[model samples]
Target: MLAKQRYNKILELLDKDGIVHTAELVKLMGVSSETVRKDLEYLDNQGRLSRVHGGAVPVDIGTTPDMPGGYISLQIRNSQHLEQKSAITAKAASMVEEGQIIALDYGSTSQMMALTLKERFHRLTVVTNSIQNALILAENPGITIILTGGVLNRDEYTLVNDFSATLESIHIDIMFMTVTGIDPVVGCTDQRLSEIRIQNQLHQSASRTIVLADSSKFGKASLIKICPFEEIDTIITDGGITPLMEEKIRKTGTRLIIS
Candidate 1:
């Protein structure tokens, strides 16, 4: 069969069943294992699918805002991807060093990451633009929490639309950010213009940028593109990430942590 034909069949099977194993691909395509692997590798390189151990899976996706969803509420967001968020937060927290300066962007996942930092680290200097992050971390005397000055996004309990002198002045050791979309083509993206402005600044100031998102975010695009795949240093997400994506991320030299 032509390589293009095989690629189409591979994706077709993935769409129907969500995963295509190597053995199954060989059987279905009437091709050798080497030929199937090369086909999967080529498709993976194009960001058309994700490869996994012994198989490949479809990259689950949602609407990439050609428009916008507006600002979302904290209460509403909390109900989303509970297990995935928990796994992401745990993995993100594990990478923190005791005395490094960490910057957190506002999101439920970022909130959970901060709490984990508070529970695990001592003498840590943390900076953020989220009111929720400050309130949660303030109780931990061992952690020094710096609240960036900004205008309020009340629905999200986040401070945005203003630049912080505090944020610009410090050198962030590691910045943990969350986004509305995580796509191969679009990279990191957000729906809020104000948040995007702040995130751009944060991304610039931080030494290392690590995104905290769940599996649901993969292949989705949002309103504003934050950076390319190469710009991010790491992505800590749930184990639901596809092999193709894992391979893509690894190829970019971005550390992929699947919780």
Candidate 2:
């Protein structure tokens, strides 16, 4: 496609999705990566789209990236992002379908997601490491909660060590994970290395991996990286996402849902 055609196509995609990926444009326009980058640059320079880490977001989403602090404990995280986490998890929980096996990671956001899952389905088999999540989800008779049988992490209230039992036992339909940080350059990351083993096992076992994080997760790189951003199928976050990170996610073709 010509430059004009590519520009129009990119705008059309942005109109529908609120963001357009550089890689998507490369394929859609049948152009080289350099060509797509130039096209994006042209659009950005014209003030038609806001340039970001990997692609571009609609100029209207306007907000610059904010520097986030280092990792905090569960006590602190619960009080932080209360409303944003609720809204993000609520939207994420909707992706769950009946009779599907769902796996959850340890975090306040994942805990909220487990709670929001209640009454959404008549039958659900949930596997998780969060002790609080297990207790909250147990109230629903429709859900079968499988708390991981492993070492207890008192600080995080999660079980770890041997995750083979959970992974080998069942074929998980969906898995929702929580990370300390996500960056365009470093990808998905976390603070604790101990938790990565179990999470990796979960990711390997599941058919789809959905990351649940608030906008605070953006622009931050944690101590350890669990995996690349592309490894995740979808991200459900709040509106705090900056135009820069939105571009990064779209570049990898991962679905971004800003609540």
Candidate 3:
């Protein structure tokens, strides 16, 4: 196929599946791997998509104003951290117990926790803003999943809206939340205001709040602040977190667990 035609097909596949692996693109376009790489490079340079390891993800121009809400779009842009996210998830899961009610946030790390919980927990109630996490837990008879009703973010597959206000009235045993950035001084931050509202509400409603993040998320602040580190009960992260950063978090009297 012509270069233009091949690139168009690549976009079509990504639009259909939300992600496209380099090998799949090569097969579908009947092109050399180098040709596929160059095509992805060109598209990424144009700011049409973001390149991830072994694949490409569609960019969320909609989040930039003059564009629709792009929560899902941004989530896809950061989907390359699957390995580190899973480690955070495993560590978070170890903190849960049977018969406990928990609130799970909407993020890649939280999704990993849901998957891990499905395999281990026998009797638990899970409330979540993530559609993907809810669906994964739905199949497990050991867990009862409650999905917050509100606006559906197609890109991230999460729900956000006035339903968050309802969370304030109900009590949860624990909340496993995720953030875009964590600074020793600025605390936890997120890119979207809507997400911040929901996360804050979840934190207030739960007896114990645990922030699940990877080392990459540290030292970066986004557009909005969710809550201060002192408000959190604990932080679960990978060992990649810097000692200086960990010291900062520990000083807040919040337990820090490195997996």
Best by TM-score: 3
Local accuracy of candidate 1 as per-residue lDDT tens digits, 1-259: 9998998899887765455679878998799999999998998889987666566765543222332333334554675678889888888888788889999988778888877887888779988888889988898898888777778876567777766755677899989999978877668887776677677777888999999998867767777888987888898888888899777667766778888
Q: Model 2, which residues run further than 4 Å from truth? A: 1-71, 163-166
Per-model lDDT = 0.79, 0.80, 0.80
TM per model? 0.71, 0.71, 0.73
Task: Return the top candidate by lDDT.
Answer: 2
Consecutive 10-residue window with the lowest summed lDDT within model 1: 61-70
RMSD of 1: 10.4
Q: How many backbone clashes does candidate 2 have?
A: 0
The segments of candidate 3 whose C-alpha lies over 4 angstroms from its true place after superposition are 1-62, 66-79
Error of 2 at 3 (Å): 53
List model 3 lDDT by residue over 1-259, tens digit each.
Answer: 8989987888987786566678778887788899999999999998878776567777853334312223335455446567777887887888888999999988777878888899888999998988989998988998988877789877578888786667878789999988878988898887766566677787888999999888877877666888887788888888888889888888877788888
Regarding lDDT, does 1 or 3 come out ahead?
A: 3
The clash numbers for all candidates, in the given order, read: 3, 0, 2
Per-candidate Cα RMSD to the true structure, in Å, reads 10.4, 12.4, 8.3
- The candidate, 1 or 2, that scores higher on lDDT is 2
